[model samples]
Target: MKINVVKGTRDLGPKETARFQEIIDKLDSISYFYCFTEVTLPIIEHAQLYKRSVGETSDIVRKEMYAFEDKGKRLLVLRPEFTASIVRTFVNNKIHALIDLPFKVHYHGPIFRYERPQAGRYRQFYQYGVESIGVNSPLIDAEVITYGYAALSFIGIENVILKINTLGDDDSRNKYREIISEYFQKHIHKMCHDCNERLQTNPLRILDCKIPSDQEIIKKAPKIHDYLSLASRERFNEVTKLLDQSDIPFEIDQTLVRGLDYYSEIVFEYHYYSDEGKTLGALGAGGHYSHLVKELGGPDLPGVGLSFGVDRLVEVLKEIEEDDNEEDYNSFVLFYLIPVGDVKIEDVYDVLMELRKQGGYSYDMYHEKKPLKTLIQKAKKRDARFLIFIGEDELKNNTLTIKNMKTEEQMVVNRQDAKQVIRSLFFSSMREG
Candidate 1:
């Protein structure tokens, strides 16, 4: 019987693995330069942690979460989001006192969701994100946005429009919720089940409904800008002022209410527009989830953050055929040893390893290990940079013939010197900028 891997997930082969690693490594390097330290949290977090902070009515907590009971009957969930876990870690460990204010951190890991798989959406996806804790200033929100922009730029994803909005403070949102709840009351029967439930508990969510009818209806409805209090409006202005001074382009979008609950003041999403002039879904996005602190039993410290779907970002890279540049990847040299039938294969194996041990060149010819011509073809298939021949003739001369695969140049070097010579050459080839 053949058992296949689960759907909505994929295995990254060698080339694909390199592509994904390059994206993360570039982001990590750039974020570190900005003084954002790296932090990690467990994949499984307490179920109540999300339920209490992300709001019971939010889609992330109400449905699509992978929740189960462990041996002790303790409820746990595969983390669907990051802000809650990061906050929980900050409070439990007392990170604020140990670190200075504006505790900035970046995280990269897999996040779980039970939603249907799509072209770019998956049940198991990866995210690379940064969070700033213990700061309520609008400048913190602006700085997080700048970090996110720099990260995407570092990864060659620059053609994205930054759509930003504000949830306003508690005092500003109450009246807007009242207006939306009353309007939805009359049209409750017209919305999808999720929107109907969202109407009663979180009228703001109605703006995010995917249904065409709901989208059309909400367009004419009250805008969040019209209801924002004077102080909240000034804070939004301050965030944009910083963005303007930093030279990052942005557009005001009142309908950008995120799916999470604890977001307030400033929220944003990065929408990538293809060269063909269409929004190619979200490449990477994040926002200020400030109010989730006190809800998670921590101080009323505010925070701002952003996370990009690694799976979706990878898809965009593939769609544009950007990874085709052969020069961008590192080249590893390889040697193929063809064991003549009469020669003891053990000696060939021992010598080949000696070349690899003291020398750093990589090589393999596990299959079709026959004549020189066949072995050379195999080396080309593996993209080997250099090829070596070990046969009856080389054993007698105490010498080895190495050929540069690209230039087809051949050199005969002493057996002992080959190790030291190749070690220096290989290390120089792998040097970074």
Candidate 2:
């Protein structure tokens, strides 16, 4: 019997992992320039934590959470999202007290949900995000969105666009909710079940419904900006002003209401388009939360953050990869070491270690029984740039033979000086290229 893997999940082979890491590295590098430090967060947390911050009415908490009761009869869950967990860590650790104000930190990890998966959506997926806490300035909001856009651009994603909006603070949202709710009530019976449920729970979420039939009713719903207070309006205006000054293109999407309860004021999404201009969906999203920190038992510090769905972004990258006919950017082993006649595998391993220590891309053939021709062919198939043969003759003579597979050029160097010679050759090759 074949044991099938879990639905809504798939394994990432070496090629995928390499591409994932490349995107991650670029994100980290760009975040560092923006002064955001890295923070590691737990994959599991108390189920109540999300219920508090993510809103009990949100789809993620109400339906998608992978929740269970542990042996201690305590409810735990594999996190469906990172924002609440990060906030919980900050509160529980008293990170505010230890760190300076306006603390910025980034995180990358897997998140689990029980939703029906599809292309670019998974039950177990990865997310990378950064949180800027302890401030409420609109500039910070602009900074978060800018970083989100920059990250997608850095990964070679093309034709990306930013959609931003404001949900206002509690007072504005409360008033706007009342208006939209009453409007939806008139047409409630004709809408989908989800929107009907949302009309009673969180009316703002109804605006985000994707049901084709509900969208027309959603479009007629009261806009949030009409209810925005003077301060809230100016706050959103300032965020747009900053993005404008930075020359970052964006549109004010009045209907953009994040699925989380904590998100207030400014919210945004990075939408990606393929080279052929096909919309790939939301590649990244985030917003500001004014009450989350205080509600989570931390200081009354306002925060803003954004998260990139690594899985979706990977899909986008794969599409671009095929379109551009790009070769794998990950390292292809530069050389393969083969142990020949009467030479122990250890001999080849020693040279392999030295080559690696000097930052040379290399691997070793352990079984000496394989013919030299076969080993060379294996190396060629792997796209290895060179083959180093450790034979009894070379071992006795204390010399190494390095052959450039592509050019069919061979050279001999004293074993004691092999590392330096290889380093010089590698560096020279890089410079010439």
Candidate 3:
């Protein structure tokens, strides 16, 4: 019997895995450019970590998280997001007192959420993100958001628009929440059940509802800007100003109340637009969370963060890569080995290893002998630029036949110099780059 993969999960085949790795490599390089160090976090955490940081009313906590009691009778959850886990780490390790200020770290891993899966979404998904703690400056908020934009740009994603908003500080939020509550109360009966509950609980969430009718009602609701305290408004304006000075384009979106409860002050999301008119939801989002660290048992340090949906970003990257000019992905392989006639592959294994030691991307077939036509087809399929044939004749003659798949040119060289020629080709490509 064949065992099928779970409904919302998949095994990425070889090519797809390579493609994902390529995207991640680009992101890592960009992270270095932004001076964000790397950190790792566990996938499982005490359930309270999220409930406290994400809030009980948020959809992730109330309806989506995969929480269960372990054999120890302790409640644990497969992390639905990274911010809380990272914060917990920060607190438990006493990273605040031990490390320098503004401890910025980037992480990449899988996150689980028991939700209805759709295109570019799954119950188990991957995320890449950064958290900057111990700093409350609007400048840091702008900095992290710009880093996110730059990372996507480096990956060749096009037509990306940054949508930003301000949730204001605590006092500003309280005043705005009261106004929002009062406005939504009158239409409580007409709104969806979730929206009505949110009205009395966290009315800010109503703006995020997907129901068309509810969205229409939310549009007329009071905007956060109307109630932002002087300090809150100024802080927000400064963030936008910094982004503008940095030449990062963005627009203020007052209704963009991110779903997470920990976020406040400057909130931003990255949206990618395809020329084909396909809409891939927010590629990534983040905002200031001045109270989360304190609330989660850490020192009263201000923090801001953002996470990109790796699955969604990969989808976007694939689309962009597909539409790009073919020349962008030149078909070239470092080396491909073929065994001709009755010659055993074992006889040529040492040569293959030598090529690998020289840092060439070399591959060989399992079969000891195969038809030249079949071997040539395999070479073409793998995009092998240099094809080397191993046969009794060449082995005895101490000579090698190298074929350039690109130009269909062939050359014979002494067997001992094959590695040198291969290294030369590799170095030539590097020099051209």
Candidate 4:
């Protein structure tokens, strides 16, 4: 018998894992700059959590959720997305009562869904997102959008177009839903079976359908902007106005209702195109929700959030990096020590301890009794900036021989002053860079 990874999931080896970490680190830094505290949520929750927050009409609850009954015969589910769970955490912990209004939080973790894997998509994929709970303002909405845009920019993902739409307030959304329902009902017979099902539940989801045949009818359907209430329209104008003041480019996509039911106003997606001009769709998306916290048995607190498909972002970034010939900074070795000629580990243990004490540097040593040529080759593969040779002559002289791999320069320095010399060299390289 043989064992293999389950379908729709795969392992991330060294390189991929490093890339994932690098991305997470960048996101974490940006989130911190924006004053977002990090929080970890459980992967499992009651099945009703998603159903109540995400809505049973959405595809995630209806089809994609990894739902099962626990040993207690109580229904449980792997979280399909983060917002619902985050809201549950907020309510259950009473964070809103403890913290100030608009409690901001950021999170990154694995999300489970049972959909067929596609390009840049997985049934078990990671998500990076932020939630601003307890407040609902146009400025906060714009700020969340700007934060996501800034995060992607900091991650080196270029040419992202912000596609935005307004779902309006509850009353406006209800009115539009009723109007769109009538329009889709007239053509429901000609639409896909899923679209027919959506018509009975959420008519806005019909706009999210990808079937080519259904698109023509969907395009002909009523636009939400036409029915937006005065307040909803003003709120949207304020958001767009703030974005304009920030000089962030965007497009008003009236057709983009997003896939979730919790979204009520100002939904947006960050879209990107490949080098070949093929659309990769949304790298990330989010929107404002008015009733989720209240619906989850908490106070009537509105919130806004955004989430990036980290798996898709990683794949897209790999392609872009390959084209740009980006450097692998993760594998860079600041100092690589190679013991030349019959050098025992015990002989140079003190020097190794000194290097370890030099807190800000990354160094490694070759302990195997291999040829000097082989050792140098290994150092080159690790992209060592400086090569340190430890042998009998240097040990006797109480000196260290250092070679700059980039400049091909060599120098011998007193072991006591080696740290100073290396620090100078490192700073020089930084200045040059």
Candidate 5:
């Protein structure tokens, strides 16, 4: 019987795996530079964690969550997002009392959501994000946005527009919700079924509806900014001002209420576009949550964070690299050992081990006895920089033949001097650079 991968999931082959690692490494480096320590959270948590923190009215809890009952009669769910789980970790561990005032942590892993798979999206996807807990200042919010922006820029995703909005404080949101609910009630028949349901549960969610027919009605609905309380508006202003001072370009999108319900105050998304001006939607997004920590049974501490869709970012990187004709440096082989006519594995095993042990180098050997032409083709296929051949002649003369794949220059060197010769040839230009 033939079996296949589950729908909406994929196995990342070597090239994709390499690209994922490269992107993750770059983001991890940047996170460390910003003094954000790494944290790993479990993939499964009590189902109520998301339902309570992410909101039962939200789509994730209402529709997208992958929930199941364990054998122990316990309801569990594969985490749909990181923020709530991270907050739960903080609250459960009493991290606030254990660590500094604001606990900054970064994390990366696969998150499960049972949604329709689309381009750059999947039922199972990866995310990298940072959360700064126990901080309420708008300055921290701005810094988080800047950090996300800087990370995307570092990953070669520069053509992004930062779309920001404010959900305002509790009072502001409550007032607007009532007003919007009343307005939508009058035109609810014209909107989608989900919008109609959202109007009854969380009216703000109507603004996030994607149906073309509902958009006309949503567009005419109230904007959150007009209803924002003085304090909420001032907080939004401070965040924008900080961003301006930092020279990070952004747009005030009044309709951009993030999908999660816990988000309040300032929220933002980094939207990427193609060279021809086609939008690829949000590559990453996050917002300030005023009550998430307290709601999760922790102190009434505020937090801010953002997360990037790793799968989407990898796709974007592939596009950019393709457009620029970039080389796959991650796959470039430093040395390829070829065994020619009547060459035994034992004859070149020492040299292979030596090259492998050397720092800042990668080496692979053609173990099977193949013709010289076939060996050369294999080396080329591996994108090898240098091809080292060991055969009867080399075994007898105690020498090695090395050929520069790019320059096609060949030279024989004493077996003991091979390492030095290869380093001098490869590192000369790298050192200069």
Candidate 6:
């Protein structure tokens, strides 16, 4: 068999990779505006970490986790989601004990899934996520949702819809799970395999079933908000009030149970129209899971957060790329130095080093070993804006010839003055991020 990339993976060259970076960068910028510093958790953790936190019965841990045993026979798993790992970090480090109130932070990196690949879905993908822990206030829940919307909007994902729902508080959710299992007890055989599994494992997840028959039946089942305890209902109302004051539009989607079972109290999803803004799919999603910190062995503090599907976001951007018929906006100013012969190559090398030392220029193929005409053509192909000719005449006179590729204007200057000319084109350190 011929060698190639793995089945559900992709090799992103410069252009595609840059696009990916830009999207992530924009998200980080938006997140920073909302007081989210960055945090990094490991890719692999003990298998029990996810099993306990995300629930062993949920599709993520049950069917999708890429779990294996290390040399020590310890069960290790590539993280399927960020929240579990984030909480594990917080608990392990006793971060809650150190920080005051809500510990706001964000994470950005690859996430693994073993599901069959399709449009807007990939086996190996990336998630740029944020998590706020330690606070159980309703405003914190609303803050989590609104900040997610802000990240998407900052990236120009205009067609996103905010789907809001509550899983009741921790206590009320246990009751709702019980009611659903009892209500759908006899209908098990008629339900889809996933639903049947979810029924026993996480009954609330059954409400998210895609089976046409079961969906109709599940819709009439009990709404989770009805079961919310006094504290739970009041917390949900406070979250809604903050959302209203912030003027972020949302819809109450009772059936919007997350794939993982850790979410509680307040939950929501940000759905976006894919490809040419047509059908709906999740570009990003997140919500509150108040009990996760406690379950992960942390203090009795609540947590809430969201993560964006970078693969889907890229897929949507690809559609826009094709529609606009444009590639990445990359402008490379190739500085080509003309060389007369190998004898003068050392001088050209020195010039290249000097340009790089100035901190804003990149040059290639300018040695005297390469012909001047050949290097000039290479620079042209790269859309170079400035052509610097360093040849035998310049070496003797100690002058430099600078050609502006844009205006085709040529100027001859002393060696020191040439540095000043190039410096004017690129900004200094103060202007950089």
Number of the predicted model whose lDDT against the real structure is largest: 4
How would the candidate models be sorted by lDDT, starting from the highest? 4, 5, 2, 3, 1, 6
lDDT per residue for candidate 2 within 110-137, as digits (tens), equals 9998888887899999999999998779
- Superposed Cα deviation of residue 19, candidate 2 (Å): 0.3
| lDDT of the structure predicted as candidate 1 | 0.80
What lDDT score belongs to each candidate, Candidate 1 first? 0.80, 0.86, 0.84, 0.90, 0.88, 0.79
State the lDDT of candidate 4 residue by residue for 8-40, as single tens digits. Answer: 998886577878999999999999999999999
Better of 3 and 4 by TM-score: 3
Query: Model 1 segments beyond 4 Å from truth?
Result: 322-342, 359-361, 367-369, 423-433
Clash pairs detected, candidate 1 = 286-306
lDDT of 3 by residue, 1-433 (tens): 9999998998886566666788788989988998899998888988999899999989899999999999999999998999988888888889988877888899999999988889899999999999899977888888898899899889888699999999998999999899889899888788899887788679999888889988788889989998999999899889888999998999888889999999988899999888977877899999889888999888899999999988898788778767341322324456788877888778778667766675646555545456878878877776666788878888899887877666667778887787787677657655644
- In terms of lDDT, model 5 sits at 0.88
Higher-lDDT candidate among 3 and 6?
A: 3
* Candidate 1: tens digits of C-alpha lDDT, residues 40-66: 889999999988888898888877899
Clashing pairs in 5: none
lDDT of the structure predicted as candidate 3? 0.84
Q: Which candidate achieves the best TM-score against the true structure?
A: 2
Q: Which stretches of candidate 5 lie over 4 Å from their true place?
A: 323-332, 429-433
TM-score of each: 0.92, 0.94, 0.92, 0.90, 0.93, 0.91
Give a tens-digit lDDT track for model 6, residues 1-433.
9899887777776567777899989998988899998998889888898888888787887788899999999999887888988888888888867878688999898888889888767778889989998877777888889998888788877777898888887689888888878988877888898887777677777888877998888878878887889988888788888988998888889899888878776778888775455843777788887678888887788888998888788777777556453454444654667666554677788877776776657765443465667877867877676787877788889887877776677888887776677675334222431
Q: What is the Cα-based lDDT of residue 417 in candidate 5?
A: 79
What tens-digit string does per-residue lDDT give for candidate 5 at 1-433? Answer: 9999999899886677878899999999999988899999999999999888999989999889999999999999998999999999999999999987789999999999989989999999999999999977988899899999999999889999999999999999999989988999999988888887888788888888888988888888888898989999999999999999999999998889989999999999999988988765799999999899999899999999999999999888778777443444345577888887777887677778876776567888877777789878878878788888888898899888988776778899997777788788788636534
TM-score for candidate 4, residues paired by index: 0.90
Q: After superposition, how far is residue 121 of candidate 2 from its true place, in Å?
A: 0.7
Can you give the lDDT of residue 217 in candidate 5? 82
